[model samples]
Target: MRRVVQYSTGNVGQHSLRAIIGRPDLELVGVHAADPAKVGRDAAELCGLTEPTGIVATDDVDALIALAPDCVVYTALGETRPMEALSEMSALLAAGINVVGTSMVWLVTPRQADDWLRVPLEQACAAGNSSLYVNGIDPGFSGDTAVHAALSLVTRAASITVQEIFDYGNYDDYEYTGTAMGFGNTADAERPLTFRPGVIATIFGGLVRNLAAHLDVELDDIRERYEPWYSDQHIECRMTTIEPGQLAAVKFSVEGVRGGDTVITVEHVNRLTSKAAPDWEFPPDGQSGVHKVVVEGEPRIEMSTSLSHPALDVTEAGCLSTAARAVNAIDWVCRSPAGLVALEDIPPTELIRGVMW
Candidate 1:
């Protein structure tokens, strides 16, 4: 059994902790809590489990490293603190702990990451002979594996588009939905950090570039487009309140263009409420969220994936999938060669085992 450490207790991290505890092939050795109050608590209590796991959460990185875990499931928020996230992951890797995480979306395709970002992690892995893999629902399975699976059914493909359509009404992360995304900000206010030029590309562009590279297609340039929808009335979401005429939804895409034609695209249709964007795409059958892949070619293929959990809301279930993507890959990541491992590097069927269902 591989010893594991869970590196946060946020939305995704909690799920990661729970999955690690549920799995019979993994041992929960330690947990790193970002919040001071969470420190010293039992891992099970932090993740909503009724029973204790005997393992306690800590804020000390060195203490976690001292455990000598085979891998660490990192789900820390990295969108705003990219550098700090990088440094923390690097420290883990350099200390000989393999890592699988949903943070650092750019690392989903490490080949496309800038040298400054990629080199340090590579060096750390070399120093410790460890490996790091990063993925999640959107930049993780939807854009990579799921889209590739759809492509296999097509004889020829002209353009590929991956979409994440979700209603964030139940999403409870205020810092993300409010400050980072500007979901409740007035339409006239400055664009949120996420809507700024190149931010979308930095986050989701790696998927486009990775797809293009897989097809052996050279991209002329990567382009971005942002469109916002304003609320017609006051709308209160679990995360933030949207006033009349305030931004409530956003539709954005990062496209990979080749010779003036877009080849690969990653798009998101995120709304604070269903009423925010009537014209924009919505999940089929009134579902709150769905990840879709559309390929236009000889035989057009469209595949949509929706997730649900009996005890959790749609948004929470989505977070569980994100956590599972990395947690399930623990064994493969541990056995793989040292360095940044990409989705393509992993055997498609190697990680499937011990499913509860």
Candidate 2:
């Protein structure tokens, strides 16, 4: 069995903690939480699990690293503090602990990552003989592994389009809905950094570039576009309230250009309400969320995936999947050579069977 340490107790971290405790092949060793309230709490209680696991959450990164478990599931938010996240990841890797999580979206394609971000990680991994992998739902399974699987059945492909259409109403996080996403803000309000130019490129550009690499094609450039929809009337939900004409939905797209034609595209249709943007296509499943990848080519294929666990709604299921992807990869990453790896570098089926096999 692999010994595992969980980092953070946020949306994904909580799920990781639960998964680690439930897996017979994994032994929960430690858990780290940045929030003061979560520190010293039982791991099971933090994740809503049925029984207590003796493991208490702590804030000391040094203590967590000292565990030197087989892997550290780092699910802390990196969007607000990328450098700090990198530093922590480096420290864990240098401590000889395999690292896997959703913290760094750009590391989904490690080779394509910038030197400033990649070198320290590589050096650390080499020094400690450890490995690091970053992944999540959109930039992870639906982006590379699943898409590549779909492409394998095709002989030729001209373009690939992947999308995440999700309704934010089901997610009960006010900070995410109102502040981070700028949901209730007016159109004149300064745009959220998430919508700024190159931000999409900074976050998901690797998926486009990685797809090109997978297909043995070259990209001319990667481009980003953003569009927002305003609510027509005041609306209140479980999370936050939105005034009429306030930002209700946002669509972000990243495209990879090849020979003047768009060859790869990734889009996110995030809305506070299912009906917020009638023009933008909602999930065909009619569920709270749906992820689709379309290939415009000889076979012209389309793959639609959804999440609905017995006890999880679409939003919670999404977080669980993100945690599952990273947690399940722990064994594979720990057994592999010391370095940064990508989804394409590992057996995708491990995501299905987990560490059971």
- lDDT (Cα, tens digit) per residue for candidate 1, span 1-357: 999999999999999999999898999999999899999999999999989999999999999999999999999998789899999999999999999999988898999998979999999999999999998897789999999999999999999999999998888997865677788777678998888988888888888988998999999999999998888898877978888888889899999999999988899999987888999889999999999999999799999999998889999999999998899899999999999999999988875755553
Per-residue lDDT tens digits for candidate 2, residues 1-357, read 899999998988889888899988899999999999999999999999868899999999999888879999999988678899989999999999999998777888888898989999999999999999988887788988778767887888888999999988868776653566778889999987777777778878888888888778988899998988999987777667888889888898999998899989999998987758889989884778888999888888989898888977788899988888898888888899999988878876665665554
Residue 333 lDDT in candidate 2: 88
The lDDT per prediction is 0.91, 0.86
Query: Model 1 — TM-score against the truth?
Result: 0.98
lDDT of 2: 0.86
Identify the candidate with maximal lDDT.
Answer: 1
Q: After superposition, how far is residue 232 of candidate 1 from its true place, in Å?
A: 1.3
**Which segments of candidate 1 are over 4 A away from where they belong?**
none
Q: Cα miss at 163, model 1 (Å)? A: 0.3
TM-score of each: 0.98, 0.96
